[model samples]
Target chain A: MPPRIQIISILICVFLVAYVFELVRRRHLSEEYSMGWLVTGTSMLILSVSDRALELVSELVGATLFTSTLFFFGLLFLMVICLHFSIRISALTKQVRTLTQHVGILDHEKRNLEKKMHQAPWQTSDSSLEQI
Target chain B: MVTPEDDRAESVSYPEPLPQAPKTLIIIPAYNEGKNIGAVLDGIQKHFPEIPILVINDGSSDNTETIAQQHNAEVISLPCNSGYGVALQTGFLYAVKNNYSLVVQMDSDGQHDPANIAVLLEEAQKDDCDVVIGSRFIGKAHYKTSFARHAGMLLFGTIASIICRQKVTDPTSGFQVLKSRAIELIASDEYPPDYPDADFIILMNRNGFKIKEVSVTMHASPDKESMHHGHKTVYYVFKMFLSIFVTLLRKSPKR
Candidate 1:
């Protein structure tokens, strides 16, 4: 790679890596949570570097490396966001199931308590108390 | 037909005996606590041997499972480190499927006193509470947590209470006794991840389960280095708050 292209590649990699690190630091991305963003960031940087090597061919196609890189990154981000949403959906489903099960148990317990209350002799009207 | 003893018992209140429901299950979720879980299990076994203990080894690369198994605890090993929420919900699922009447969640870090486990059970059984959280800040005990973490917890608890429309003193307290229903409710597929205590508590309240908090002493963990500090702590706080906000926006399920 030429010195200028190499510098550009290095800068691109640095910017993307730093941005992802910032996401993690800001709690936008969790370190142990998932590998989606890291993969996306690294892959996008590689694509940017390769596209620069093909700059002459790309100029024939009237596309700049910067624009193409941004476009690819946008797609990568969308994919990661979609993955996150799916994970959230699954987690939410588990929460709903657990919540319903708890409700059912509570209902069952309430009914049992009600039955006991009705069956208790103390719950009945006492003629002996009236006599006293 | 009322003898002196029968009259005394009846005078106390209702005469019907509440059949001893299924035994309460104690769930200790531990990660890399090889040094603590064995002792914790022994302490619990010595004190409450009647109650079964189940340890959810949350993908510990250490000897967490071996320690738990050696200590006679029923072990449920997760294949990977799925965070505390997954480990806890797994315990709840186990409780529900096994027909346990109540479930107690205690950390395996040895910070939580095993003797205090009975207080949680008592609150659940006597008050008929759907959930009883062992609050470290509620009573006279000295809270040794960092100021930032303390403020974070208070804020989280207050917000959780408002969202759930119920009083929640220690929404993030891992030490809790949950009625079978409460356990089953949070074992749902949509259970919030990372610091799920608040969201799960709110979920119980939304489902009409009673929630209560009891003050308990909290001792510092012997392994201070085990704490997740710096950027990780920031991430935990950020994710926890975000999860709560997102959870609040979710529409409640129709009865």
Candidate 2:
């Protein structure tokens, strides 16, 4: 790989790591989800800076060019991160659904209690709402 | 037209009615159904004045909640637009929480006639049936549907029929009645979150619940498409298959 491209790659990795850290500091990104990105950024920085590491990765990946090997690993990292996000999103969707239901139920229960307060115990018809 | 009054069992003739306490609760899950909710509530109210009606409003942008409230029906408005299954599970949760002995869940659309509530109740009263499904394809319902939907319904109905060893014609029918045990089970984690159609019926059957399908007539939905339309139809089919397979894979939560 040309020194120019390696310099650019190193700068990008530094920027990625700095941006992720900034996001965590500002609370835009939580540490739980940022771990993958941080690790990927750090690994990319190391791969770019160290020629020995870059050569070994290129030979292991059977890539003629060092840059292609870097690109392959970068792409692989992105795919893994995307899959992780997808899994998190699905879990969050279920959680949100359950939360929404509980909110609706609680609201209804509050209203029922208020309505019951106004009515005499004998007059209220839906008195069995609590036994279950 | 079989009206709710026709063969509507009175409280006195309930075949061992529970001490006049409100045992039966009708749960209506509605989403953007302001147009027909009033009439639906009125029809149910007219026939069964004693039974309490609760409507689970799925965060409709329309005046569905207000209309349901105006009809003197208990309304549980979800905070946001949720699926029909979520709205339904909410109703089941409410029923289970309230200790209602019997729960009749029907569609919010005008398609399901309030008159058929009695039909379901009668079926449950006759035997130890935990779930009474009001089948549209049975007998002389004459309910019309799109070709794709009809095919899907037939496919699942056939699957359910074979498994349950009963003639399950309407696996997708939303108009049905559930006893407390059935209601509690559906509301639990065992129930699928999205479209709870054929898989749920089969799940109940596998769990040792007696499911009875009674012939009931339903009107064709006018100016309204099914909830499983467009992209949702594909997802519904895929989810239906996956959930059915999953239901079979999992062990019974309750005997």
Candidate 3:
């Protein structure tokens, strides 16, 4: 019922609502691919608004509730980057597989051509490759 | 203990007609063919009872896997439908691990005649080749294929022949027989998943593997529409040709 508690509660609701809407709007979160960031954000927002925890932590760290909330979000952002890179690594691995296959095919053709040249009546070495 | 005679016998026909014959495995890649998979398997079983069959259920949400299982076919359900290329690759890998001497791939749809599999295997067993493709154009049948599909196939065949530097009649035909050595090489990730018909010919040729086309009968799929859309046909052709160009330009894998 205190004024500070009411203000913190309203702020927590605002942060949680904004976080949920932003995630939905940007299409970052889906049923199948959720990274649990929304849950983390909700928990952080609640903890930041808890008057007892805020008073004790603010007293010890000398930081306001708003700054504490910002810190939690920054941590979430870092986690998102990590998750993104993991997906990218998987995609790159598939690409590397395809590239290796292409390289293999070309190398095989070169060897066949070399063998053909050696069997030819007028054979030329690599130095004279362009003449033929 | 494989003598030259044994090698000679292998190149002659399917099942090899020997007591110590190598096991033959057939892989059918199915996508959304709930109705046709059952009939295809039935016809295959009736024709080649000795061969074990495996169906690569390419992430079909339908009863393809269930029906395949019902027909006593081994099923490897891909987590998602990667494409026809990946489905066949999975089957090739299965063949390699299981030590199958020969692996045959037939469309799960009833369009591909299972009886022709025996014909392909006979040609494949001949010691000179690694890949034997079933060519509808080669056989003396009614050959009722559409002009558009035939044109597409011919174009692919011509491009593949140029890239592989060998004559190829049906590059896009999915039905074929592959030797164990060819299977090991093809089981790798490089095989194209969509429109693999052309890329595979070039891949085999580059690996110093012999590829030959034999005439076989293939009926039109009772189901009219192909899995690929009209736009996808263009995309598939572009990607297939581009990959062939790039593959031709790249170096082969070292032994």
Candidate 4:
């Protein structure tokens, strides 16, 4: 890798790791999900700091440039994360539909109970007696 | 051969205890059908005076809930616009909770004749039938539909018939009667949300549930837009085929 590229990547990796840590600390992200980001950031940091590691990984990835290997892995990680989000969204949609169905049915039941309370004379008299 | 106990045992088989009378609940899923809901409710109420009616208002922007309430039908209003399948599933869930033996689902567009409810229910009463679909194309009923819709229905119906080994004349019919098993199925995790048409029938058949069809009279809708208009037709076909294929790939219910 070029000298300038090495210095910039190291800085970016440091920033990414620190940001992920901050998010987890502030409760914006849970530790379980943050593990993926933290792992990516650490791996990038190690590659930027050690040229030997990058060269070996690039050979395995069959990339002419070591930086291309990093880009390829980063793209792959993003695709996997997007697919995970899609699955989570589908589950949430089903949950919302079920809850909406329950809400409608429960509302109907509540209205029926209220109607019965108003129609029954004894209940009305008992409420009036309590008020007195 | 001379033993009296052996003779008695060979001659007679004990019968299971009898089931109580089957109770029916009518579920109508309506979305902005305030214009036509009144007459549909009235027609059904006139025909079946004692049966309970439930109108699922799918977050209609119009006065559908008020109209259904005025007609003395139980109205449940979703907080937001869930699709047609969700509304019907809501009714099924309600039925399962309330101990209803059967549920008849109908459209609020008034296309389905209320008098046809009897034919569907009678078919569902059979021991082998779990679902009774009221088809407009069966028998000599001459109901007219748009060319595109008719073609789509024919294609899907043919596919369903081939897969299920029975003639399915109308795969997109919104009218049907579901027995207790079918009602519990729609409420369970087995069902998918939205567009419970041919795919649902295929799923149920694969799960060992019997599907029967009855000929019924149908009239063209007065106002609602056709499902096969333009862009929607493309999406409907693609999503429908994909779900059908996926349903085939999934592990079927153990009979």
Candidate 5:
């Protein structure tokens, strides 16, 4: 709305975009997930630099106040980001569950084999003989 | 009418004889059931002495693993709590790997009566079903529960019955006997990770697995608060509805 606020918003958007790119470059974040942050940061930068475009978007969204329109879009962007994180979390949860199950079974089998070996070292040789 | 045993005998009298006794493994999934697991394991051992028992201790803060091992049940300790579904699936994987022909899943909370395991085993041995569920609602057994939980079970049972195209009386019952076919099928990645209740039954049915229910007695859970309590109950209802709805919309899973 004001010139000073617009300048601060542009600065923040620039920093956000740079940080997201840095993360991608470092391979800390995958390109698939970084796309949302990149779009949000670039959109904010564009809207902040162009007052006419902001006013037009506010009118299109039927908001009487420009700040309210910006807040609305910000909230909408946040909702989308939250939804994306939730989907990723769901996939990770499934993967973690599968891994945990396998690990538990394997650990159990290893302990059993160790105990059997301790009890009867000769039994192991019988199995090896059978294999031969 | 010829009895099932007599029919089996008559069939065996022919060229090909009946298959040998199926190797059965009892799997008990325990989570924070340290207080009750010992007695449950003892009961199973007393009644089914020859059958091997395996307990999947689901990363309980208590001494569930110790108690299970002390009772002579093979303990598979999960590194962390991964919920009931994952623990049970771990047991399924173990059964498949060990080449067990039948797997009997019983809770470590002492709710499921070990005496009724024979009923489930007999029903499973009929050779007509891939899975046999031990149901509490079908028999003279009286299992008391909170009104909300009972209502939830009824709701899910109705929905699962409609989707499964069969009468599902106790869709929430966890005590079951799975043949090798069902065991192999569930060991796959399609098994639900959380509450594997009515939605799972529908999935198995859609996958062409024959499911049969036998009446069984059960004791009330020792814990005052169920795993599905106040707010958790609401989330459970929402999650189950979403899961069942999505499952219905998806293409039928291959056998």
Candidate 6:
């Protein structure tokens, strides 16, 4: 890779790491989810700074071109991020369903209580007296 | 046409009546069926005047709740539009909590004929089964359904019947009668949150619940289209197959 391109990639990686850290500090992104991005950003920074490491990675990955190795890692990172999102979404769907069931049951109970209150005005007074 | 009075008379004289008619509650899960709910409730009231009806208004953006209330049917409005399974499960939970011995669940779209509630209840008692399903495919009732839906039903019916070790003709039928035991099981967390069709039948069977099928007449909604319309038919088939396969992998739930 050209020195200018390497310098630019290093800068972008640094920016990514800094941004993710800032997001974590502000409690916008949780540390649990940001760990993957942090690792990816750090690895990209290391690969951009070290030409020998980049060359070894390209050879190890059997990529004819260094840029192809970079592209492959980028795609792999995106796929990992997507997989993480899918796992989170699955958990969230289960949670939402459970919450909805609770809401439905609670709503039904509330309606029944209100109906009871309407049917017998003295019951409310009895409850108030008991509370006092 | 069978008059409401005739239907009531027939139900009263049905063979093998219980020592006392079980305290039955009809659970109607309504989703944006304001236009049709009134007629459905009226039909139920006309035929089964003694039985109380509870309508779970599943966050419809229409006057479903109001219409049900107007017809003197108890309305339990879910805060948001949950799926069909959630709505039905809510009713089951209510039934279990209120100590209803027999709970009959039917759709509010008028597809499930209220007149057949007697048939389902009788079958539940006669067969000594926990659940009685009203199957459309069994009877001579000319229920007009789309070809794609019928094909999908056939596929699911075969898979469910094999897993359940019994012939399940209409696994997707909403008209069902559940005894207290079955209601307790369904009210638990084991019930599917989405389409609880054939997979639910298999789950019930695995959980030691006896399920029997009774033939009943069902009609399509006048204005509403089938749930398996167009591209949805393909997605429905795929999702149902996957759900059934997953259900097969799950262990038998504890009683």
The best candidate by TM-score is: 4
Candidate 3 residues lying further than 4 Å off, grouped into runs, are A1-132, B1-16, B225-231
lDDT of 6 at B121: 79
Question: What's the iRMSD of model 1?
Answer: 9.8
* Window of ten residues with lowest summed lDDT in model 4 chain B: B9-18
lDDT for position B91 in model 3: 79
Q: What DockQ do the predictions score, one after another?
A: 0.03, 0.74, 0.02, 0.70, 0.76, 0.64
- Predicted structure 1, TM vs. truth: 0.62
Taken over the whole model, the C-alpha lDDT of each candidate is: 0.70, 0.85, 0.72, 0.85, 0.84, 0.83
DockQ preference between candidates 1 and 4, better one? 4
lDDT of 5 at B94: 91
Off by over 4 Å in 6: A121-132, B1-9, B12-17, B227-231
Kindly report the docking quality category of candidate 2: medium
How do the predictions measure up, each by TM-score? 0.62, 0.87, 0.63, 0.89, 0.85, 0.88
Per-residue lDDT over B1-255 for candidate 3, one digit per residue giving the tens place of the 0 to 100 score: 233433443343355366666688998888889999999999888777778898888779899989998998877776566667667777787677668989888888787777777678778768999889887676464456667677877887888877777888877777888898789877775666554667778877887888888877667778853444333567777887788888878787642
Model 6, B164-208: lDDT tens digits are 779999988888999988899888877877766888898898888
The DockQ leader among the candidates is 5
How many Å off is the CA of A68 in candidate 3? 41
Residue by residue across B1-255, what tens digits does model 4's lDDT show?
133322332232222323864888999999989999999999888777778999999999999999999999999999999888899899999999999998999999998877778667667767888999988897766788778888888988998999999999988888899999889999998887876878888999888988988877776778764322333888888988998899999988765
Question: Of the true contacts between chains A and B, what fraction does model 3 have?
Answer: 0.00
User: Per-residue lDDT for A123 in model 4?
Assistant: 72
Model 4 TM-score?
Answer: 0.89
Report the C-alpha lDDT of model 1 over A65-93, residue by residue, as the tens digit: 65564465657676777988799888776
